[model samples]
Target: MSDADDAGHRRAGRPLETVLTRPRITAAALRLIGATGYESFTMSGLARSLGVAPSALYNHAASKQVVLQWLQDHVMTMVDVAGFGAEPWDTALRRWAWSYRDIFATHVPLISIMAVLPVTGAPQTLRMYETVAAGLASARVPTAQIVPSIVALESFIFGSAFDVAAPADIFETGALAESSPIFSAAVRQGEQIQGKARADVAFEFGLEALVDRIGRLRRP
Candidate 1:
């Protein structure tokens, strides 16, 4: 065929769509984890789920951990930090903490991965830290205390998020109820509190205490 005919034939064909990219890979990895737990996660498995060869994934990601890093960065982008600029530090932190907790409560698998992962190449994660740091500084918290404060807050948030995922009967004393009367009675009382999930109620209780303690840092 002549060059003109060949060019027309190419134009008549449907446009090819991009099959692999950082976003696509991140999404696929999250779905795989949600469906089969991270224990079953693998680069080959992800590639199969994405309808591509295992080698094709390497063009975008170096390893499974790299994809997980991408997922971590993407997840951080979901946290709400909007109150940081406009609200008092306490208010802003409450908003951010609730958002952060809610996300990881459902993403328990990622909590450990993110806790130990460095922020070197994670832009969204870095942005989150920057916002919180600036908010703390704005509230007159000492620069030296900012990092430590962040670490402490994150530790609580991670623990709270994990708690949110525990079985509903986690607090149940079972056959040992008679041995732990006071604790069992309180658990029963907590179950009677209306309108909120027990985990949420507990999280709010801790969040309030944390906010109070952190706010005190700004005072003499």
Candidate 2:
């Protein structure tokens, strides 16, 4: 073909080539989810968001589950696991727990889905796990306990992420305060605490306890 013909052909194929990458697809999927929410998210909606046909999206991601896996992996990259090897195990665990909670605080919609998502094909997710597991092992945690320890930390982190997004008055007793004086008093005391947000305070409390408990799991 002539140079001009070759240029035309390349130009014709540019739309799909430019927009159909895994990154692009994942980005579009996130945008769609953010706009319409996970419940409303669909492959057709994702395709429309990217200005492509559903078939094109399907060509890259075989199913919605595949796209979700892509998103899970992409989000996992944001979690801070660097401290695992560089810092003491407890310090690394604290840093990772805080970072995980903060990152997922804005991504609460994905929490339920990711809880069940397997790490089999997700490299970034697997890498995060490997780093954490290795860190715990290096701390001398028993081999059989590593996975359970990680799961325990994750359960706390995920729950705290949801808590981070909760309303400031979520626990406000309001009209029920009179009948629930003790609980209401504690809530008032919590509100009176200075500096850190209530969520941060609660998370710190829980994380410190977990870190201390897990640290004890270290083998002699």
Candidate 3:
């Protein structure tokens, strides 16, 4: 009877720990920033979205940049490209590249910050780069080529992510039509393959092509 009463008491009590520490501000920031770029997304906007005044957010965050840093850190972790310690780098690199693409696709809205903002927060971007560099070292891809290779891979992946986020109108203005067909085709392609299959297929293709090019370049 006492145990039953204790169990009932426990059940009646709220588990407020998760509520007390609402650390998943990452999702909130990403959703807001992704949908409305940081420049225009205001405290009032966040409050409206959260069903609170512009003041409530102060409990969780101070500035938009804090929110941005939070989102950036969270997103980077979701992308598994950062390898740890010594191992054969090929699999890690492939995994990292593919993972990076998938996460970007998942957070296309949040990733726009990567353009002008300096990388910051919980997950260290430099550490990720260093980790990849260490992996390339194991792969015998040449000491001098390590940094360049990493930079190239990052540029390709991030550029693709940005392409996904950029508005079609940006590429289709009056003078922009000359290059708009490619964007038009890409839009069609995005519509055609707007699912897991699309991202997986394109990333795999690009990653393999890049690895091959790097391998050939490193050849003696």
Candidate 4:
């Protein structure tokens, strides 16, 4: 074909549509947060990273809070809620708790935001809750107690995520060791324990206690 004819045909083709989408926005938001942290994250910054104007982002998400809610839901997808129906209640709870703590350990920055964020519009987050609630209900836990129980586990998991990110010598008393011998010695003893991480040990110990208490809530 002639170059002129080819150019005319190309001009007649459809204009390229904007590829912006919720998943793309969610991905870009996460990348932005990982690079600059939540403190610096902004709708304008997200648009910059995505190669679009801030108005384009607003087309999918109304506000930064809404974007964060979307991010929260996206992060929830990484957690292992499948065990709820497949495993025993206690076993499922343990699996879910470990997965939750581990996933959030790398995402400690999101914890404060997510802790207070409601699950109302976050479908994945709500789905996770539904699974846990169903498992607890199947174990015969009172309907009214289900939400509180889940909240208790989440409180522990969130705290544990922070603990996981803490330095190994987070308990180090150093120059003050002589002033607080017992606590210092306990810290040293904990350090001396082999194999598992201090965070894992503490999480397991606390999880067992919580599970024991929650298990007792079941009707005979």
Task: Write candidate 4's Cα lDDT for 150-185 as tens digits.
Answer: 999999999999999899888899999999999999
Whole-model Cα lDDT of every candidate shown, in order? 0.86, 0.86, 0.65, 0.86
After TM-score superposition, the amount by which residue 109's alpha carbon in candidate 4 deviates from its true location, in angstroms, is 2.0
> What's the true lDDT of residue 100 in model 1?
97
- Ranking 2 against 3 by TM-score, winner: 2
User: How would the candidate models be sorted by TM-score, starting from the highest?
Assistant: 2, 4, 1, 3
Model 1 collision count: 0
> Against the correct fold, how does model 1 do in TM-score?
0.83
Worst 10 residues of 2 by lDDT: 1-10
Q: Write the per-residue lDDT of candidate 3 for residues 35-83, one digit (tens) a residue.
A: 8776687766865666555666666677776676666666776668545
After superposition, candidate 4 runs with Cα above 4 Å error: 1-19, 34-40
Worst 10 residues of 3 by lDDT: 15-24
For model 1, residues 33-97, the per-residue Cα lDDT tens digits are: 88998788999999899887888888779998889889988999999999998998999999999
lDDT of 3 at 71: 69
